[model samples]
Target: MQKFQELSQTELESLYHDLLGKYKNFQEKKLKLDMSRGKPAADQFEISMGILDEVNSKSSCLASDGMDCRNYGDFDGIPECKAIFCDMLEVDPEEIFIFGNSSLSIMYDAIGKMMLHGVRPGAKPWSRCEKRKFLCPVPGYDRHFSITECFGFEMIPIEMTPDGPDMDTVERLVASDPDIKGIWCVPKYSNPQGITYSDETVRRFAQMKTAADDFIIMWDNAYAIHDLYPDQKVPLLNILEECKKAGDPTRVMIFASTSKISFAGAGIGVFACAEEMMARMKKLLAFQTIGFDKLNMLRHARFFKNYEGLLKHMEKHAELLRPKFKTVLDAFHSQLDGKGIADWIEPLGGYFISLNVMDQCAKRVVQLCKEAGVILTAAGASFPLGKDPRDRNIRIAPTYPTIEELQQAVSLLCIVIQLAAAEKLLQISPEK
Candidate 1:
């Protein structure tokens, strides 16, 4: 349990030799494991197989309001699906708009809309602006950064505190600039770190002022109902309500999907915002398609009769995912705890464990793991523009692998961490 820095040169050198030997043993095993993405395991999917049976040829593909789902019409969303989201997202049904299977796709379209048209009616389109920028919290989702990057928006990396993004800086930056148009947020069970925004943070987000009238908060609440521990669920204050109370109702746009709950590609994605924004969103979306897959939406609504049913279904998912998370965390404690080489957050509900290795060691550790047959999310992937300024954070995804497989991967991962740390230490030590 001693910190690596506390060891003497002689002890460090000996430890380095031991770690090198462990690394070689891993090399000999030639294991091929991938811990790159936070994908649900096969066992998790098995419990939700009944969803596919929701709409069969014998079943009536009709919405509760008697709109036939097999045909077209519900462009915004069927009332049934929106009502489900209203309960899940803690917003009114009128505030929600359902989209295709991927929330990421909806996000992309939203950004595209902002670039092509303004955020809302009568505002200037971002394309006409001389400069455009987006705030991206560090160790954040790469896909969110990618959407901004693709549109050539200047991405300003914001430091993430345990509570949330550094709001003092966010407030200052937004107050001073009209060019800073938006911020990408994953409020509950955030992508890589799994830190939910504190209530104060959400309130500040709602009340923060910007020079630009069109300033928006892209709230991707992907894990709103994804509780690993069903009994001790964390509650998130609805940002839409906060914004409305703050008299900035048009400031936040919420996104969510059931990709992890049921099926990845076949799930329903929903978009929620103020009434003004939703109206603009609907008008823009009408130009793109006649309507989304209402049958899929009906299937989801039927499978999970109410919000309670969705939560109950997620319990089965938790049964499969909990062990995998524990296996990795237990391995970290057993093998790397108090070593001074790495640190990580124990997430409550999200799919990843954010591990921070010594500066300059993450890339080396990832390379060493890959060479030893374990694939990991690339170093610096959690940051904007694929660059982690410190090059220290690594996202650990445990849900996709079985417990045994996860144990093996974590075992090798620990070895690589030690090997990389020792190598870096030895290079700097005067005794070398």
Candidate 2:
């Protein structure tokens, strides 16, 4: 259990050879295991199956406001659905807008709208500008970066602290640069790292003055109700409310979804902003579709009657996910603990576990894992532009695989880490 760096050159060489031999053995076995994306396992998806029958032939198709669920034209969202999300997101019903299945789709549309027409109601559209930039919190979500990149915005990487993004840097950057149009935030149970923003961080974000009149804070609270421990849930300050209190009502856009709660692709997505901002987005959204899937919204409203029902459903998810997270963490502790080869965060509730390998060795470790029959989220995937500056972070998604498969995958991954680290040391050691 000694730290690898503390060992002698001879000891390091022997340990490296041992790990290499184990890697070869695993490769020979031809194991086909994947830990790539944070997808719900089959059993986790099954618990929400009852919602499938919630709006069947015997059910009422009318929304609370008497709009027929089977019909069109409730573009904002059915009242019942908005009511549910309002309670969950802690926003007014007028401020929330419902979209079809994916929140990512909503985000894409929001960025596109900004590109074409401006983020704020009357500001110049981003497309008309010569330069545009987005502040990306590092060790952050890949898809968020991809979205900004697609729009040709320069992604400025901001370092993430345990509390949140380095706010001092963010404040300075936004204050000095008018072209820095927005920032992507997972605020609660953030992707990869699961670190929630501190209340002070939230307040700073709410009160900070940006150079750009149209600057936006994209708050994607995907795991708002996704707590692994029901009794130990972390609460986030309602950013919209905070912004309103700070007199910057339109500064933040909030999003959430039931994708993890009910079904992956079949669930509903929610978008909430200040009333004026929501009005602007709705005008843009009207061009896209006459209406979203209201029937699906109705189905959700009936299935989960209120926030309490949503919480109860998530508890079921936690029951399934907690074990998988524990298994991964336990394996990491057993094989890599005290070795000084890597570091990681133990998330209370989130889809991924962020593992930090030695600088310059993450790619090698992932490649080694693949060669040994395990798949991982690509090395450096947690940062802007898919480049981890230190070449370290590796995102671990344990929810998709069973405990037994995870056991094999995690075991091999640890050996691969040691091997990669050992090789890295050899390259630098004077003894060589």
Candidate 3:
């Protein structure tokens, strides 16, 4: 196929005319859809209908450990639940600590606690210090950015390559800058882009020597089990294990949850870290609450016997999610396959399709879709402080929509792309 740059003016004009005619036909369809957030569909949640049976009116409120789940007492969460999440997160049961319903809240608390009363891990509290910066990778989770944004930390946005974040830049920014307190990472099936960190990237992360002892790697493995392709899900190098191999187990804070596995707003969150880190984390947790919901923890523990059981259940999840992913993927390639106006990656697994339009056209593309009644993730959501440097990347979530809805929605999305790209290209053409 000829490259867009090599195309003659006549060829370009002809191509534009064809796409414009296609876009006009799309306007007649007048589809209404949303590809905004990575939410599980109602059918997916049916798998957890058994949760109602995990505990019942006839069931005992007593936990396996002897703690009454009815009342608060387990300051660190029920041990059984920690064991279950330990398997879910692929860490030692002893290394895992179950938290509240939402991991995002716990993440905020961790940073907030440090702000108010320095990191009690024998480091300077952030309140008294002036230099506190965070490393943020572009095309990342927006909510993750929101968490860092709240603290007023200087966010350094790193460009995300196919393999992962630019590690050379990461090494320099992390090692040389003492002010670089932390870096947010979603290594496995990363948000938006759905690109997993390679083993080499993990090795680089493990070998990183931060200037600050308290420097943390907030690893939010949110979509670890939401693999759309069960067989092809790229397993992470286990940051905790890798850290130990590098003699830095305390550096990475591993966060995972059943948010997508079970229910979105009601699932449990876990934080797996080295013992030393946990001690500091618990020190901060002491002021928050005496304990989290142990009953919910017990329910999850009994529902998933161990790691194998959890993996088996995730397979069922993939069955429901596969069609949704294929619907959008097929539509994108079908309509935009040879178009030089845009490009995207075919992710092996995960809940999103990251589409990149021609330079500086993300906002226009999204607006075009919205006008046709399909909402998308915000235009610049994939960058630090919500500003994509290229202004072209867009994240498409296919999980919540049904297969039919996804097909129609993706079709409309193709219209948005074609219209936006044509207008932008025409502006640069000599014919304009």
Per-residue error (Å), model 3, residue 159: 1.4
lDDT, candidates in the order shown: 0.90, 0.91, 0.81
lDDT of 1 at 47: 85
TM-score of 2: 0.98
Clash list (residue pairs), candidate 2: none
lDDT of 3 by residue, 1-432 (tens): 454556677876787788667766767777778888888899988998787588777788777779888898877778777777776677776677888788888778778877887664556888667878999998888888888888888899998898889999999888888888888998878888888999999988989888877788888888787666766778777788888999988788888888887778788888888887788788777877788888788888788866677788889988988878888778877777887867888777777888899899998888877877788999999887889888999998888988888887888788778767766766654233
lDDT tens readout by residue for model 1, 1-432: 899888888999899889878888988988889999989888888888888999999999989989999898988889888888899998887789999999999999999899899998888999999999999998899999999999999999998888889999999999999999999999888888888999999999999989889998999999988888988788888898899999999999899999998899889999999888888888898899999999999988998998889989989888888888899999999999989999998888989999999998899889889988999999999998889878899999998987888988999999888878887877854123
lDDT of 2 by residue, 407-431 (tens): 8999899888888899998774412
Better of 1 and 3 by TM-score: 1
lDDT computed for candidate 2: 0.91
TM-score of 3: 0.94
Candidate 2 Cα outliers beyond 4 Å, as residue runs: 428-432
Error of 1 at 66 (Å): 0.4
TM-score of each: 0.98, 0.98, 0.94
lDDT value, residue 269 of candidate 3: 84
